[model samples]
Target chain A: MIFRALIPAFMFAILIVFFWTGLSLDPSKVPSPLIGKPVPAFELPRLSVPEQTLSSEQLQGQVSLFNVWATWCVGCRQEHDMLLAIADENLVPIYGLNYKDEREAALRWLRELGDPYAATAVDADGRVSIDWGVYGAPETFLIDRDGIVRYKHIGPLSAEDWENELRPRIQSLLDNST
Target chain B: MRVLLAALMLLPLAVVAIDQDPPMADPQLQARYEKLSNELRCLVCQNQSIADSTAPLADDLRQQVREMLIAGRSDNEILDYMVERYGDFVRYRPAFNDRTWLLWVGPFAVIAIALVIGVRVVRRGMGEVESD
Candidate 1:
């Protein structure tokens, strides 16, 4: 009886420990204040559009979303459809910075999936990505009308994020706009 | 006569090999040391390369590696010394051994054990005592 009782307790303890260790394993969860600041000034060549470039100046007048993605990335694909849905709603101008991707592959990816970006710029060498303090691809930054980045959502967005995080925040920003 | 001449030439080479140490005298040794230092993981940092880490311990380890190279230690000898002092954590790739079986096979073993125990426990507890 004691062995059986202790076995369950031991199992529970081990499970709890595993969960705690997993939680503590994420050491790169440090937050950045660059979220509420103005988008860093940069000009990058357009990925598909010829003789065209995208700049942070274009984000000044309206509330916009800057999405950092790449053709080689997987999470970007998961977020692509949601981005397209948002774009379809015409909620905000969704700008894209394709980090360290071949122009041809980026074009092909967009052709297969769908391009949700108002303007997509190619960051061929990832220099722009580094300047933006990007650790990896598929990070979304929401910029307010005054060109201040109000929110930065790392990784892929989900329905919970839409309802709990995005809607409330965007509604507030919109309310403040009027 | 030919064998004797070959032996005569080989005698000087053997003598030179014994007298001349290859570690400090070679320019390539310093370059190799620098390259290997960066490739090594900082034990404290866990995620950072020794070259990239700004930790005091990492700095000390880097300085020790440099000192070992300067002191005419062979690459293998230096690695052996570090392995002896710090164990496998000092290396980016720890070798497979009895102590590191947990590092290599712990996850798989845990999963297998869990599956076996779960199946046995569930099988013993299950019954057709269904009520409509």
Candidate 2:
């Protein structure tokens, strides 16, 4: 009799636990389906010099970071210093996908701040970004030596995020490739 | 003459305010495009479907669906393409699978349990009345 009465309470407790666990998780961090798949093919003009095109073929032969950012995105500015620092260390080549921003504004932003990217591509219509399944600005993908995307980080990356998650992943990929 | 001039002045403003792109050439294809767009969730907006969302990402996805349709892809192929890229989260009505089994079955299970409990409680109350 007691066990029968406790059943509803037990079920209610379990439901509460599930709801609590679900609520605690960050909703912004949606897992990318492109992980372990080859980087989507794209041919975009260089942000610095529009006449010269930068294609996905160039991304082959080395582990690299492809960062989708825009001059208008506030989060891109937040993560800019970390990107600059990453570039300084020369750990991996950082390629920028300048997503749907005016040429003058993007150029000025990079000029005023610093150019962290080895080569920045202009995704004028955001077609390439769509191919990469980029829902918003300031998303980063880590591609391996063979051009397979290994990791995807959404939102502005912090210094702690770099040290703990990104750096170690890059190091492990580098170690395995050689 | 003054009213005509005012109407002309308002024309450009009206054009600028109307945001949606013109409908596609093929009516059948356009119908399919609209249906699929309504079904797919806007990742940026979360709540609104791609057809209703004004987000740039939603616009891109809509354009992608149109292109795929033009390329002679079927509705299932287009849906598969989106699901492959964005995961099951892009679908407003998620498929029944391992991850979604509880979501599909939980409501029915709850109802069944409630019915069982109600029967037991009613039977106990009936017994008490008979004893009285």
Candidate 3:
């Protein structure tokens, strides 16, 4: 009787361990093929400059950081200082996608907060952001000279993010530059 | 003239009787509906909340939640109705009660019971001498 009762409990314990272990996994820690692979193609209108356009093709033979941000996103405001610091260093060119934001508001925010982007593209409908696999605003992607995606950050960048994650990746890309 | 006045008085009551359920639109009620749908879990798609899910049952539940909110029902009252009708499984975070205590504590309880039983079984087997 005791053995029978224990058998169900043993099975239940094993099942819980299996499911819990799977849930605790962090996808960011795992290597993504998109990492070190060509950045996906997209074309979008410039946010501030009328009749002008931007595309991933323009990044050929040059490293750049692609940031997806919206005026409505609180997290985007938090990472503004880090982005300005990155731009100050000029370690790599920075590109921006003003995702799902109105033209006037986006331009005004940049003017008020100090624009860090070399050029900003407006993805008003968020189609380009979707292609880039952006689930939310304030995501950043790092691309190498050959137009390969070297890194991806899901949320707002911090000082520690630049030092620990961005800086090292940028260094590796620069080292590999022909 | 007397008959017309009597009919007018009963007309609003008749309309109310036909509309047994509540109205579907009201700004404050809509807000409550949106909040509740997002918080409730889809039973079929355990990973997704009802607001984010495309499942048919989730859609029905969303509409039901909206109806309840529109009826001036409090959050707790709506939740209680669902719990009574569908049991606690409908809730994303099941309440801590006798029936659901198994769900919340099942894993820990299972591990503890297993450890105790395994040790006893091992001790008993060890006590028995093996024949050559």
Candidate 4:
């Protein structure tokens, strides 16, 4: 009888515990469905040379990083140095999706910051970005040799993130491919 | 006369600015498009539906929905496409699945528990009164 009377309190306590646990989680870190799926197909003009177009087919048979960014995105600026360092290592080819940004401004920003991307595609209308399910700029996807998106990182990429999260994943993918 | 002519000339521009260009010629299809767009949450805004959000990503989604609707895709097909791309978070009301079972059943469970407790307390009070 005593235990039966305590049931409501126990249930209420459980509810409170669930709510408390939920409060600590960041809603923005919602996992992408594209993880483990093939990267979306896109044919976009090259940022440097509009006459030349880049397609998803070109990304096959190599581990690559597809970074969605814009000159106007402050987070992209924050991640620029880390991206440059990664590019310098030549461990993996980094491609850029210039989302809904002006050609002149994108070119100028690249010139000032130094181009870290092997090939930057201009998604001027942001149509291609939609296919990639890009909600905001500065989202990075790690694509495997078979053109499958192995992992995605949202928000700015920091040195700690690269060292802890990105490098390990890249190494594993490279190891798996060979 | 000139002012009247200018107003008439600007009418089409006003329609374009308001984004009132209907996606399809059929009224039923346009209605479905509007309903689906309003039901979708803009991932960037997080708070507003795609129809209400002015975010660039929202605009892209709206355009995609329009094109898909024009292609005669069913409502469920379009929604599944969005879910495939953006996950369940993009839907304003998520489907009841393994991951979301707690969310759907939690409220009713709480209410049922409360009712049971209330009934048991009232019964105990009645027993005490009878003994007195």
Candidate 5:
């Protein structure tokens, strides 16, 4: 009789635990499928010099960062200072994927703000961005020496994010690649 | 002039159609495009399918679906293309894969558990009444 009485309490406890787990999950931070996969092949025009093209080949030889940014996205602006600071360290080359903005406005943004990227690729129609699985602006991908995407950071990256999450991943990649 | 004014401005005319591209020439292909767009979820606007979303990413995805249909790509191939890039989250109706088998089975399992519990509870109640 006493054992049967505890059943309701057990079920209630399970329900409470289930709902509590749901509360902590961030729905927007969907895990990327390309985590262990090679970076998707793409060839897009360079943002600075449109006549020239930037291809995935450039990322092949070194561990680097691929940052997707646009002139219109506020998050990209928020992360720009961190990107500039990271660029100064020269820890890894940062290649920018300038998503869907006009050439002139993007060029002006780089000029006025500061160019943190070693090369900026212009994805005008967003076809290349689709291949990269970029859902929003300010998403960053960490690529290793062989051009495999090691890590993906969604939203604007913070200093804490770099130090805590990304730097460790990059360190492991560097340690393993050698 | 008044009629022109009424037609252009005074009438409560709300044009929701913003697609500049003409409809696909092939009706069969057009149907496929429509079905696929409605099935694919817009990652930006989590609730709406790509067909219903006004987001630019949704527009680009819709264009991709239409173009793939016109290019003679199978529906499965088109879906695979999306799943490869965006993962299974792009599908509103997730596939019955190893990861999602639990999701598909979970509701039925809960019902089965409820039935067992209900039967046991009722039997126990009857036993208590008999003892009284």
Candidate 6:
């Protein structure tokens, strides 16, 4: 009789676990399907030099971070100094995908704030951004030397995120380098 | 007086024209475009469908759908393309697959469990009272 009565309690405990896990998860962070997939092929004009393009070919042959940002996106500004600091660390090259911003504004942001990107691609119409599944600014994709995307970080990258989430992934990817 | 009346009559038509998005030439393709838009979720505004959302990303996706339809892509092809880039989260009605199989089957499982419990409860109640 006690065992039978305790069954409901066990079920409730299971339900609580499920609910707690679900509640703790950030709904805004949609898992990227592009994980372990090749970075989308795109060739867009560079923000600094519109004549010459920054293509996906450039990102290959090294582990790098492809960061999507726009001057209008406040989060990009929030993470800008940290990005500069990360570049200073010299662990990996940081590439910028300047999404749908005026060339003048983007150039000015880079000129003023300090350029952290090895090469910045200008996605003027956001078609390239869409191809990369970029719905918001300041999303970062970590790509391997083989050009496969290993991890995607949504929103601003903090020092804590870098220390805990990114450093370990970079280390593992570096370890596996052939 | 006649000119003023004519201008006034045309004002609403002009407003309506300006208010409307330019409809695609082919009605069939236009229908497909609308269908795809409603099916797609706007990632920026998570709750609203791309069709309903005024978010810039939604507008871009809607335009993209129209272009893809015009380019002779099938509905499934367009959906697959979106799913490839944005993942299944872009689909308002998520497809049944490895990640979402439980989501698809869960309600039915709950119903089956409820039925079993209900049947057991009825049987026990019937045991207490004589069955007609």
Q: In CAPRI terms, where does candidate 3 land?
A: incorrect
Q: TM per model? A: 0.53, 0.85, 0.54, 0.86, 0.91, 0.92
Q: Write down the TM-score of model 3's second chain.
A: 0.53
Q: Write the per-residue lDDT of candidate 2 for residues A88-136, one digit (tens) a residue.
A: 9999999999999999999999999999999999999988887788887
Off by over 4 Å in 1: A1-26, B1-46, B50-132
User: Clashing residue pairs in candidate 6, if any?
Assistant: none
How high is the lDDT of residue A62 in model 1? Answer: 87
What is candidate 6's CA lDDT for residue A170?
A: 91
Off by over 4 Å in 5: B1-15, B18-20, B127-132
Locate the minimum summed-lDDT window of 10 residues in model 2 chain A: A24-33
Task: Residues A73-164, candidate 5: write the lDDT tens digits.
Answer: 99999999999999999889899999999889999999999999999999999999999988989899999999999899999999999999
lDDT of 5 at A134: 89
Query: Candidate 6 has what TM-score?
Result: 0.92
fnat, candidate 6? 0.78
Identify the runs in model 3 with alpha carbons over 4 angstroms from their true place.
Answer: A1-33, B1-46, B49-132
Candidate 2 on B34-101: residue-level lDDT in tens?
89999998989888899888888888888889999999999999998888788778888778888878
By the TM-score metric, which is better: model 1 or model 3?
3
Ranking by TM-score: 6, 5, 4, 2, 3, 1
Against the native complex, each candidate's DockQ, computed on alpha carbons, is 0.03, 0.56, 0.03, 0.63, 0.72, 0.70
Candidate 6's displacement at residue A5, Å, is 2.1
Which candidate, 2 or 4, would have the higher DockQ against the true structure?
Answer: 4
Which is the leading candidate under TM-score? 6
Q: Write the per-residue lDDT of candidate 3 for residues A2-58, one digit (tens) a residue.
A: 998897899899889989997897533322335666876888889878688898899
Clashing pairs in 3: none
Candidate 5, residues B24-50, lDDT tens digits: the string is 898888888889989998998888899
